[model samples]
Target: MLSRNRAAAARSMPGEGQRSSGRAAQRLLVALLGAAVGAAVAQADEPILPIPPAPALDARKLALGQALFHDKRLSNDNTLSCASCHDLSRGGVDGRSSSIGIGGAKGPINAPTVFNSSLNFRQFWDGRAASLEEQAAGPVHNPLEMGSNWAEVLGKLSRDAPLVEQFKAAYPDGLQSRNIQDAIATFERSLTTPNARIDRYLRGDKSALSPDELRGYQLFKAFGCVACHQGVNVGGNMFQTFGVMGDYFTRRGSVTAADLGRYNVTRNDADRYAFKVPSLRNVAVTAPYFHDGSARTLNEAVDVMFKYQLGRSAAAQDKELIVKFLHTLTGEYQGRSLQQADPLVARRP
Candidate 1:
């Protein structure tokens, strides 16, 4: 009942001919009808849905992946790692306007949080990577990021016999670049953040949201923010032009190539300024917002969205309420609230 998506509902239903009979069957039918009615009501009222439980993953692969994620050997200089930019303990981001990479090089775009990244239809702000495994390989070879090739990375990683053993334990063909990517991606898939206050409310716990939060949610929908930021990940399922209603780049000034978003990937004129909508889960802590990392706070980001994306202005009270709603999107990670994690202290080179 937490999801209105038919595919999600079908996935949770019992398989094949498992059924009840007689009074049990009749009672089951009644219960199901009631649930269906409730689900319908919820569907009409809410577009966003609760994150499902993490999929069961191989423990060995998960452990190996996490190790690889933190190992600086993946970088050419042995001074940077996946965790350097995506800090799992700190909302899965490094908390910079743009990421600082190996050898003190700076990346052009803000690093999107790795949390709930698996739910995104495509990886990266431009939607260039089709899967997490592919995305994993990007930074390692990016000149401004890890700045390493698989040959160099494997050569360094091979020196560690213990790490090689980890590879052997996790994959049939061990210590290969593909396996490393697989292991890292497998670990990343485990980073889903669930059980936020909105999730509880969506799951039929009416008291989960305070009156103000509820009002904020109502305003979020009424103001059409839900048009782009809906579904399970609450914004990752699709792509939209950054300035759907107005010219955000010109107004902001000094637009760079990164501001082109999907246009860089497809080289399509229509794709200019288009980007994959980022997930809002744990968004409160994953600032500053947007690919440029221009917004310093949620309020500023919301104001920008209203002006450039919605082509409208909101009442100050309405905007404030919407910010309150966004705060409720922060959820738990590994049985702990994400808010409990320390904010990213910028690590300058």
Candidate 2:
């Protein structure tokens, strides 16, 4: 009886080890599968993408462009430069409801940020300028803005021997209006602000955003803000009617010719009030929001968007969260965060 019992015990012990090994393999498989699912979920959820680093451009052209951007001689009276409206140190905006140009003239539409302008499919608020080069020529020619024609600008700039020399060095064609535009456009292209907290998160740094900020981003997508404001520049890739869900201009009233938006360019009735959706990158600092520049604060801007653009209402808490998430989109320029470089000029949300 003792010998029979010993044999049975040995057989049972062998089966027990095999059973334990099988259970361990199953657990490992489940863990791997769970990890894969989590990754898939994360990928599926994120619609926005990270801003890529500025492309490698010619150093000579970039330097020439940077000089021309800040040179007030581009303006008629030498009072305003490109930097006057699109100040790089100040989130590439003048922080006004509408940019003030030469002789205290106020622009009709808000001056969109020069930062990341290269990423945009079209240049101005109405999507009138198709390229950065075309856009650069605009302000100089505009009567209310720089108030200078290409010929006048060339005459003024030619007086500066050093600038002419630099232009010649940068372009074989020398100091022409087209070359000037190219140089300024080249510098504008370099103004892209990458390395935002949201960008890091998009690049798989899970720890990049705080809990509330992450929640805000989720709400932003859930609430359909991402429909117009996605892609590398966050919102510059497309055009959408400002008041899709509601008549925004009617509510605001006093709609001007500028408010006609893309209609001015296309002359199509359907394109009325349609504007190139402005990029939300660094929006926290570039305040007095919208093409109309009506929303004075980021919070107000979000509210207006919810009401007019989405035609929906969100809780106060959700709106607050969305604004917080927007704060994460403020990115680094020249190795410094835009917030640090220039604190938000607008009142806090």
Candidate 3:
């Protein structure tokens, strides 16, 4: 009876057209399965995560903060603004190896990018400033930076009727130092860049990343580079010694007080040469790299990382591929590509 029923069902089945359609569907299913497995493998090896878009902020406060950010009144000399070191038009950095402050005084360490700094667990290379608000206050009062006290700054701001009015609209206390810090910090938080090709790939767009970029990402993880550089900000959530496998400072020669890194803040020997891991977002544009800015190009930076941090050597091709992946991390700022805003240094051979 089973055989008879099977024969009847076969007889009722569609002709060659339906059979061909079924075969095609099966092939498609197999192809999809293969792609899914590939993607899963890629994900398992991916360590760095994509940055999310900036959250909605109060427009009034953001506007006020932007004005204050560009206003030179914050500096004692009236020649330097917050924008002097952190140039919004140049990848949120001044493009100097070490930033120049008031009266042409150079800072001890390299200035990290201001973009997406709020994502960092702690501010500054030494992690001295706990939050963006605290970080904002550092340069303003530092003898080398803006070189002005709150009294001087507020006195200048108070003279400007428009700025004072804007401050009143943004803060209940108006032009106080705390309110200024709050406003600048809020503006910094809004500086996040999202929607990079790598981010799109992370969001499940299979075609977003090229074959080289995907390979580079896998290699980046396999090489243990991800251990220190994981999470949304890539490398900002924790602190790591600059020279894990080698004496980087000694080799570089010229170890300054800034090179003491987190040791300066903690005063612990264990924290020697330890610095807060900087975010890799928009890194391609924000060079020269590292706390000292020793590496002038991305290729050179990758080499330095492998030698000092990873203690592992990679082939030149592999290094190039890794650099390619890094390039994909440059995202859009205000609906435009960020790389276009800054002129990158020429690549070294």
Identify the leading candidate in terms of lDDT: 1
Ranking by lDDT: 1, 2, 3
> Per-residue CA lDDT of candidate 1, range 218-280, in tens?
999998999999998999999999999999999889999999999999999999999999998
Tens digits of per-residue lDDT for model 2 on 95-212? Answer: 7888888999888988888888899999999999999999989999898999999888889888889988988888888999999889888888899889999988876788999999
* Stretches of model 1 off by over 4 angstroms after superposition: 1-37, 40-45, 340-349
Candidate 2 regions exceeding 4 Å error are: 1-45, 340-349
What RMSD does each model have against the real structure?
Answer: 10.3, 8.4, 6.8
Query: Which pairs of residues collide in candidate 1?
Result: none
List the pairs of residues colliding in candidate 2: none
TM-score of each: 0.88, 0.86, 0.86
Q: State in Å the error of residue 64, model 1.
A: 0.5
Clash totals in order: 0, 0, 0
Sliding window of 10 residues with minimal summed lDDT for model 3: 340-349
